[model samples]
Target: MKLLLVEDDSDYAATLSRALEAMGHDVVVARDGVAAIEFNDRDQFDAIILDRMLPQMDGTTLVERLRERGQTLPVLMLSALGQSIDKVDGLKAGADDYVVKPTSVGEIDARLHALVRARGWKGEGATTLRAGAILVNPGKHRAWYGDDALDLSNLEFKLLAELTRHAGSFVTRTMLLERVWGYDFEPATNIIEVQIRALRRKLTASGSPDPIVTKRGVGYMLEA
Candidate 1:
């Protein structure tokens, strides 16, 4: 899952981001509501873990704004313990679920899964995504190009899934590093180049034209 984690506490955010990434979820941290909005606008995410009390703009207000913008993605609000709770406000404002701070990552993961299932991802988070002849089913951990089954390693499968998710759009190296590799820092190795080449090779081995496009220094785009 690609996740947007909104929190102001650096230590808590870092700790939670590590835990979530260890669970195979790609997490992007946003320190405040303003930054959260920017991240939300620039990238796609399966869900958002938001802090209720945020600087610049509060979580509830942010939820309202997001809804007003026609964004229906699941938002799980994090409320600090001992604070006055407002279940009505959050629900009315369009937050899907609420979790108290200091909750287990397992619980958060479960809630996120449940939310996705309940909403059926509003089609955007469908179980399978397709890019022209390419088909990727993350839930089943399988992919295919045309009629040929793709026997992909875990990394290749993830890379393909990311490209399929944003079909026709350039998925930058930085985005792939964060989403597909789950790395906050860029490594010295040419992991992206290697994996992309492997994917391209497999994709075209069956006599199909290469659908993945290299935009020079920009990034890669999978033809739609």
Candidate 2:
């Protein structure tokens, strides 16, 4: 994921950037709220880690401005002010999530991921999807492989629905993480592979040919 880190403290920004980069995200630093808004205008990013207080525009004001301009990107506001009123102000101004200062970096990462997940399928407008032998009805929370009804867990259903949308195109691990789990980067676990194996088993349980194709060093594609 590409992230915008808005922090006036150069040292804190550097450390946070390094940590997020190590998590497989691309980080762009904006030292002030005005600069952050400028960066937003120039390019798209997955999310923003914004500081509550800054030189020019404060984080809450920045969030309000962004919302006024119809920007729906997720934002995580960090503040030394841990008062309930401070957090309420951030959310009312349209920050997706707020964290008090000195919070664990892992907690911050988790909150960012949660925010993205909450908005995951908003832009896609996905409905029932089909690819060759597979059919997935997201609204119905159901799927079928050529008349063989599939009983899938929530995760499996989401994974299959994503693959069915692409049909013949390769869906990379990173893409699956973002779309299915709202994760911006590949996790340390073999979650994608594990889900793929489960989905394959169900798709082939009725003696149909395996429709999922795996490419070495690439990704997975569902045959059409």
Candidate 3:
């Protein structure tokens, strides 16, 4: 995986960069929070490793700013401060995973995998979600459209949840495979198209116009 490692400590950054490289990850080292933010804008990375404390902008503030700008890449916050409250604060600021400093490479790698895997699984903690005329209760796996309850199966619910999460943006078939089906490898079947058709049928059963848009040769998008 390609990663952005942000740290003010040059020696530590070098050491960590080497270790990460040895582990087969491409690492870009950024010296401080300002550099980290700039690097993020200039490139795309699978994940970001941000130091909790940095010169100029702190880690938490940087992540919050990134989120405000609609940067959705997974972030793994690294900090020497290991308090529960500190971890909570980092997560609330949009860091996907928070780990105390002095962690093993194995742990960091594992957490990175977990963060990416959990990206579109909103059913974990989200109670309710709204996208245009659609309302979803993820906990109960129930949905509604303008007073009409939607009847959805397990895969259908997951698909709808992912589309609604990125309501105004295009959700590619590759994205659906990974996020909804949790498949790392693309399958040789048309399962996504099949399921999408099934979902559209149920969603429009009440005479509601189809909310999903298919961009040919591209992907799908949900209109809000």
Candidate 4:
């Protein structure tokens, strides 16, 4: 997932950034609330990690401003103030979740997953995805084509889920690298082509017309 991390503490921010990258998340660091707002305005992010105390603007006020602007991105507020009242105040300001400072990256990752699950890709309570004859259930880690269940590996399932989510829209190779392989830096191996080849082979095993469309130099798309 792509994330925007708002932190004034450079050292702590660097450490946390490294940890999140190691967990396969791409992070953009913002040193202050103003920088955070700028980053949020410029790009897309799966979530935002905010610090309570910030230069230029406070975290609560920043969240409130984002809400006022009609941005619904999930926010996880971090603060040294671990009191129950502090948490309540953060939530009231439009933060999706609040975590105390010095929290582990594992805890943060879990919380982010929970937030994504709550704000499902399809809808508020959507659990399944469909593109043409293909059907995918990410929560169950299962997929099917017509009446036949697709036997996909872990990575293949994730790759297919992303494709099905977009359905008719083309998905770029870069997007697949970040979303499926979770790599901020590209590897030397042609992993995307290899995985797509394998997935394609399986998908067409039932003598069905290939649903994945390759645009040669552009990207891949699942036919809707």
Candidate 5:
């Protein structure tokens, strides 16, 4: 996997970069947030490690900018402050995970693996998943119907992958929220319904049959 390390501490960055490299990961180091953004715009990375304090641009600003540009790459924010509020602020700024400084290289590597796994959780181990004519490739993060590729958002891909994995089996909305969205508590908002509706529309846009079967008040299923 490729990683972008945006940190100002030269020694820490060098040590961490070496560790990741030894683990067979391609690591790109940026000394500051401005350089980080420039590198990010020019290169594609599997994950990003960011420091909260940076020269020219802060990590929060960088994260917000990346999100605004629709870049959904997994970001793990690193900070010296381990307070819950600090963590919350980082997440709210668009980081996928947060870790305090003085962390072990092993722990950082483990967290990186977890964040990347979670991002591609739906397609991690599976090669091909079929639900009627729809086919999904979890490894490649791609999906298709017959010969046509389906353009789906990150969330849509995860939702489709989950349903297709359990084809012919009922999957409740709560399960989707918990598994796909990583939500522990149910939100009052109908996010599942909204996303499903969007997915259905995209599926049928090419005149394909809707493989997703709504189970009314119970949940959803993909017919075999």
Candidate 6:
């Protein structure tokens, strides 16, 4: 997945970028809100990670601007202020998810993954899905491949549910970010790829064929 990370802290950005790359994701970094907004206007990204306090324009204002332009990209906001009031303010300003600063990259990745999956549920009302040998129970939040139960994390379960719900349909990276991760702003991060890899590992471990079909330059689809 291609992600945009908007952060003014060079050291933190560098460290996070390296971690995401190590997990097989493509990351684009923007130093401040101005560059972040410019990047959003010019290029498409799967997801975005934004810092609450930024130069040029604050994260809240940037999100408001994007909303006005009718852009529905997923955004995860980061801040040092972890107060509930602050989180509410961010959400009211159009953020999908909010996290305090000094958060682990792993947790950020998980939250982003969840946001994407949430965005992918399109109310198809499909209760069950079969891909290869894998069986998904949407209502029960469980999956199995043959006799082996597939152990999934909360984020992983949501991811599978989304893919299965939209089985055979191409799910855009942006869509995944919006619904699954609940992000209303775009960030520069490679969270989608990271989560997919983890999900794949779990699926494959259950003796199932890879059910996820990747469309280069587009997004992902679950094989019908």
Q: What TM-scores do the predictions have?
A: 0.55, 0.54, 0.54, 0.55, 0.54, 0.53
lDDT by residue (105-153, candidate 2, tens digit) is: 7888889889889978232124446676466678778787754679999
Superposition error at 119 for model 4 (Å): 1.2
Residue-wise C-alpha lDDT for candidate 3, range 33-95, written one tens digit per residue:
888866764555778999999999899998987665445678999999999999999999999
For residues 1-224, could you state the per-residue lDDT of candidate 6 as single tens digits? 67899989999999999998887778899998888866764455667898999999898988886554444567899999899999998899888999998989899898878876877622212345555445567666777654467788988888887887687899988888888898877669888888999998987874668879898889999876
lDDT of 5 by residue, 1-224 (tens): 78999999999999999999999989999998888876764555788999999999999999987665445678999999899999999999999999998898888889989987887833212346666556677777887764467899999999999998898899998899988999988899989999999999988898888878887888999775
In model 1, the worst 10-residue window by lDDT is: 122-131
Give me candidate 2's TM-score against the actual structure.
0.54
Residue pairs clashing, model 3: none
TM-score of 4: 0.55
* Comparing 4 and 6 on TM-score, the stronger one: 4
Worst ten in a row by lDDT for model 5: 121-130
The TM-score between candidate 6 and the true structure equals 0.53
After superposition, the stretches of candidate 4 with alpha carbons farther than 4 Å from their true spots are 121-224
lDDT of 2: 0.84
C-alpha positional error of residue 157 in candidate 4 after TM-score superposition, expressed in Å: 40
- Candidate 6 scores a C-alpha RMSD against the true structure in Å of 18.4
The CA lDDT at 84 in model 5 is 97
Report the Cα RMSD per candidate.
Answer: 15.1, 15.8, 12.2, 15.4, 13.5, 18.4
